[model samples]
Target: MRLAYVHILPLEYYPPATNAIRIFASMDDVDAAVWTSANRKSLPEFNCDGVRIHRLPFVNPGTSAFLRFYQCLKWHWDCAIALRKFKPDAILYIEPHSAIAAWIYYRLLGGKARLFIHHHEYYAPHDYDRPGMKLVKLGQKAEQSELFPRAEWISQTNESRSGFLAKDNPEIAAEKFQIWPNYPPLSWNRKSTQPAINGPVRLLYLGSASFHDTYIRELVEWVARFPDKATLTISGFNVDPAVWEWLEKENFPNVQTFPQGWQYDELPERLHNYDVGLILYRGNTLNFVYNAPNKLFEYWAAGLEVWYPQEMKQITHLQEATTQAPLRRLDFNELPTEGPFPRPAALREFRSDYSCENAIAPLLRAFDL
Candidate 1:
């Protein structure tokens, strides 16, 4: 089976899209290709373990609804032409924009490829009520009303979000939807041995750090208060300018920031040194409240214990289900003052359980491959 993966974002920058394509390509019966865009930061061509990647030209539709609408139409046209040429048996479309493009190809362009939609982040109707989102809102509405019913399979990050999606689109059958939690590949597991805690616990908050609706300030301040007990490292892309400015001026002795964050492929090697991986989402939106981010599994794969907000009920449910790794819930109101937050000792035995290889089983079963 030839499968084409469609995503508007640069494939190399999005771990989930890359992971999914890799998984599909690794299958004996499937030949996978990625149709994506080249952002300013991304190379026109990328190596996804030898899978074919075709990138459309990038257009910076900066904050203009007209420009964004034009770009979207152009992308749709380009994607449809590519799909027609590729003649894929099936297509996996990530995010609403990609799904809308796939819908256009399948419906209007006489493309016969089976459609699958993956929602990396849940978005409500009102979520797209901003200035440059009129086109996006229309596309999302079309996806809910038309695409959902036609899709052979649809996936969300977790069961909670899947339930919410089903509720929103009652016309689509429940069985059509599946949960594909953001999990790292089993190959990425590099479980480090737990050493005896001698000094301060190494706490790392890796990934997108934002000033709004996150615990960045609180975490930094708390770590600053007790430099002897803990050290904080903030690293990742899309870090808010406010965060950078504050960190630059404050210059907390125990806190470090790596503005040039490590790439997704380097995570297994890069993350093992930390004792704890902090998830700092403050649950300001419904999407955030039930987020099953890839970083959680990435941290576990690297043998680090995870600390997350109590407000993320989906993560809390995952924590309850697993004894493979330790997942601690943080109470922002009362920060813990303690020493020796150690890495899990059972990582050697249980780290394999938190892999994309295992997570994608249900997806494979659904495909009946």
Candidate 2:
């Protein structure tokens, strides 16, 4: 069966698009291709893990909603043209904007391919109050504008997201939304030997540096307070200027900085060098409260125990699901002064249960290929 995977973001920049391509490539009975936009300034064609990726022109999001909606319409036209040529049996649309574009292609333009949508986030109606959220809500509204009852839905978390959609739109059946958690491929197993826990435990904080409630600087300050207990390494794209300035001015003895972010494929091998992974989101919104972030699984795949906020519902749920025990829960206001810190012991079982292959099994089953 031929499957067309569609997403609005640049394929190289979006982890979810790459993850979907990798998952689809692993299937023996399916032939998968990706359709996405290249960077606005550049349109370069490259093969990713044996899948042929087609790139179209995309306008970057602007401050004005009119411009953003116009861009979305242009993207819909591009996707419709691509659909006519590729002629896949089914289309898997990633994120709300891409799914909305696919909906337009099928419903308005009389396309024949069955539509499926993957919801990577759950945004409440009131989530538009924050920065960058207004545009996100606009895209989400596009999906909700029509029920699309026949369209299959997938979520990156279990009940947190699926439950919200079902509650919001009672017309949609519960079975329409499948719980496909954000899991990495099975090959990212930990090494036989890890960084020793005898000395100061090596820790990492990776991903986006900009968030309203990130405690990165606070973590650095705490590490400085007890330099002999733990050390931290920080890196990610678009590291907030404030974070960089603070890191430079403070120059904590136990904190190391990497200005450049690591590529997605480079994380598995690189993560084993650290003893712990830190997730310091302050749980500012319901979306954050329900997040099943990629970093959580990436850290586990690399054999690093998590140092997460106990307040996060996603973390709490994952703790119960994976090991039935709490990880090193942080209070945010305080740091431990002890010698040895906690690490996870159940990665093998976690890997077996939530590998990307296993996570996407329900998606494949839905297609009946």
RMSD of each: 2.3, 3.2
Residues 124-177, candidate 1: write the lDDT tens digits: 767889665676676787787777777889999888898888888888888998
Clashes of 1: 0
Q: Which residue ranges in model 1 land beyond 4 Å of their true spot? A: 42-45, 62-64, 337-352
TM-scores, all candidates, are: 0.92, 0.88
Per-residue lDDT of 208-247 in model 2, one digit per residue for the tens? Answer: 6654677776677777777777789998765787888888
Spell out the clash pairs found in candidate 2: none
Global lDDT scores for all candidate models? 0.79, 0.71
Off by over 4 Å in 2: 39-46, 60-69, 128-138, 324-326, 337-353
Highest TM-score: give the candidate number.
Answer: 1
State candidate 1's TM-score.
Answer: 0.92
